[model samples]
Target: MEPVAENKRGLMPGGVAKRRFKLSAGDIIFSILNYIFFTLFTLICVFPFYYLFINTISDNELVRTGQIKWYPVGIHFNNYISLVNVNSLGTSVLVSVGRTILGTSFMVAASAFVGYLVTKKEMWGRRFIYRLFIVTMYFNAGLIPWYMNMSMLGLTNNFWGYVIPGIVAPFNIILVKTYIESIPSELEESAFIDGAGYLTIFTRIIWPLSKPILATIAIFGAVGHWNSFTDSMILMSGKPELYTLQYRLYIYLTSTSNLSALMNSGGSVNTSVLNSVLNARTVKLTVAMVTILPILLVYPFMQRYFIKGIMIGAVKG
Candidate 1:
């Protein structure tokens, strides 16, 4: 027998050879094209944020003149300092942080609990309850009606406004419900046989086993809350103190009169430092980064679980 080619075989026990699969020419070309496409796509997707970051660090004049591209020119760090010095900075940060934590926690717990309840066949009105959620996915009260309802509930200008209405998310409930259904029924049966109550079984079995989906949903909740400015804009309109960081940034960018007044403030602000920070080109770029930076830092930690959970939850078992 002719000896097998080294490229076509892998050595096994006692020098026995197993056939090694080789990529076809088409496969290699397809892979190369795939890599090139994704590489270009990534650059396209990333360049805007990169542009914002580099412009943020460049001199305001250089940025405005559109001369600073590919690299930062006349580097300056005072934009960040100016952002920190905003009168509402402390309050905005506090509100954003508080709402993000509280909102994420409440939404995750509510979604998980509702998801678990729906997965139980013995639950009362299971079909009706699930259909109710499905109905929400397709239909929504218009903005005016929603605003009126919230007003009726006295959620306007309330701190709970940030955390309450978002607690019951139909999409999150569906993702979590699908994930929970994929779990083995035997586990719950075993728990029930050991005299475990519904809450106990959920806390002990479901919660721990559901980490991937939970982490995915938690990241969603956190990002949604962190980036949420519309809710603050409408619900907390009367309360400047409750404004989130993103909304504060919005006010800073849009209110030219306010920006001018801030730039001219003589008290506490050093003339040179204030001048550096008040530049339109720099402040907006820096504030944009400041608003999104936390979410950017957080996503990497959750990315692995996010991918896994989303893939698994997409298919109903």
Candidate 2:
């Protein structure tokens, strides 16, 4: 006997047919254009790093003559060794690592605290305070005046220069403030009812919930501190020991046209290896990679938080 026809509709999960929306020709065209535009944009953004990476690893002759392209030509790792040969490499690394960790931590905490306080309607002169910070975003004192201020404050030649100046970033504060305002007011009210003080409510409830925004701002602070060269150049000019990695890298890049001269001039590692690979261009590319790798590595770990925080924090209170 022939089997009965199957009830295809009832057999499907949810027992309901999925509805499909037909797109207009215009919609399809718009989507296609959007994809094309973004693909090009992504390539534009990514190609520089790709070029830098390939050039750094490619043979010196290939990089100099513009022969290196999509892939590395003659694989060379000596550019990295040249970077390691610098005498102050260890010190610069320590300075950069220390400043990044300390500065980012302080900035995140202070900015969040200030942001939370500004969200409190009970606070007096809150509008004025907020406006004061916002105004700084648009205007700044000239370089001379700023340098003089740092000099007067004795921040010159000091490690605190890196950490202190960034502790209360106005933009990060605004981001946190907007995000905090988005949080339900009843949460704070309920905490108050349970006899939670402002500090307790902040540490226990606000801080925990504010992780996404904090991580985003922490990334900003870390990148800023890590890549900061001008600050060290200006503030620690007299103190070579206080020089950061970026500052040292800056000096290396600008100090000479000849890679061999620059490498042989100071640094403890006067190896034949560095001498063999003495391609200034590739060496600079290697240094660039070293400088950016930490931040790039960090992005993958914090990417989820960053995307979520930016989207949510952008919402108006």
Candidate 3:
């Protein structure tokens, strides 16, 4: 401890400190690029929501008077209140919810079972059958044929009309099959060695292992069913009584939006152009939120599965 390296010239008694100025050209370029992309994507994603939110709460005069509102403009929630306005929106929500649950369950369960069978090595030339299903996915039999088929079977305007025909999706089978392919064929063989029947192996092993793919399929199928407008429009056309949420909302917007025709096509009442939104644009947005929000909530949960599913397969079982 004689000198103890404790001289005053020893910057810290043991060592000297150093500072650095490090900024590579690549770093600076990436910094600028990151900021630019962040801003661009922010605007791109935000604008439509901004438009919807602002219009939803905006006063008609402000919107119609040429004052663009990038934010809330006086909070007129009456549109949402009225659209949801008690039992109407609630009932529509129920219809959509019911359809989504039943339809997705029907599709996932049925497609998964069929997918399991189709994926089996001993299924003996399942490729031709699978191809037939996939072909139907690309080339539909057209509206008239579909309508005629439904009519012949009396499914048109029936509740089954919504849940049955499209419940077993071909592409969903492919996705589940791909995931199933990742599973070990040895697992099934082992189960067979233990006297487990096909159903037992399917229910106990394949079903459990297939959850991720099933969840991914569930989200897609549920969203499809929830957002289904075309099917409802065609099948329930004359029977508005059976119209689903999207279909009913479309009908409401169409019937209500044209105020000019309703109030006499060419009359000059100088109140502002934004009043047009009142006709049914407001209703349309409200209904859209109603139909979409539940699925948006669903999205966060299944999103990981769907993302991973595109890349990975389960270990072959």
Q: Which candidate achieves the best lDDT against the true structure? A: 1
Higher-lDDT candidate among 2 and 3? 2
- The sequence of per-residue lDDT tens digits that candidate 2 reaches over residues 1-317 is 96544355634355555565999999999999999999999999999989899889888877877888899988978878877676777788899999999999989999999999999888999999999999999999989999999999999999899889888799999999999988898999999999999999999999999999999999989988999899998899988989998887777676445554655677554466554444545666788888899998999899999988888899974
* Runs of candidate 2 exceeding 4 Å displacement: 1-15, 18-40, 257-279
The numbered model that scores best in TM-score is 1
Rank the models by lDDT, top first: 1, 2, 3
TM-scores, one per candidate: 0.85, 0.83, 0.80
Q: What is the C-alpha lDDT of each candidate?
A: 0.87, 0.86, 0.77
The sequence of per-residue lDDT tens digits that candidate 3 reaches over residues 159-211 is 78889887779888888888888888899999999999989999999999888
Q: Each prediction's Cα RMSD?
A: 5.5, 5.3, 6.5
Pick out the ten consecutive residues of candidate 1 with the lowest summed lDDT. 4-13
lDDT of 1 at 201: 92
The true-structure Cα RMSD of candidate 3 reads 6.5
Q: Which wins on TM-score, candidate 2 or candidate 3?
A: 2
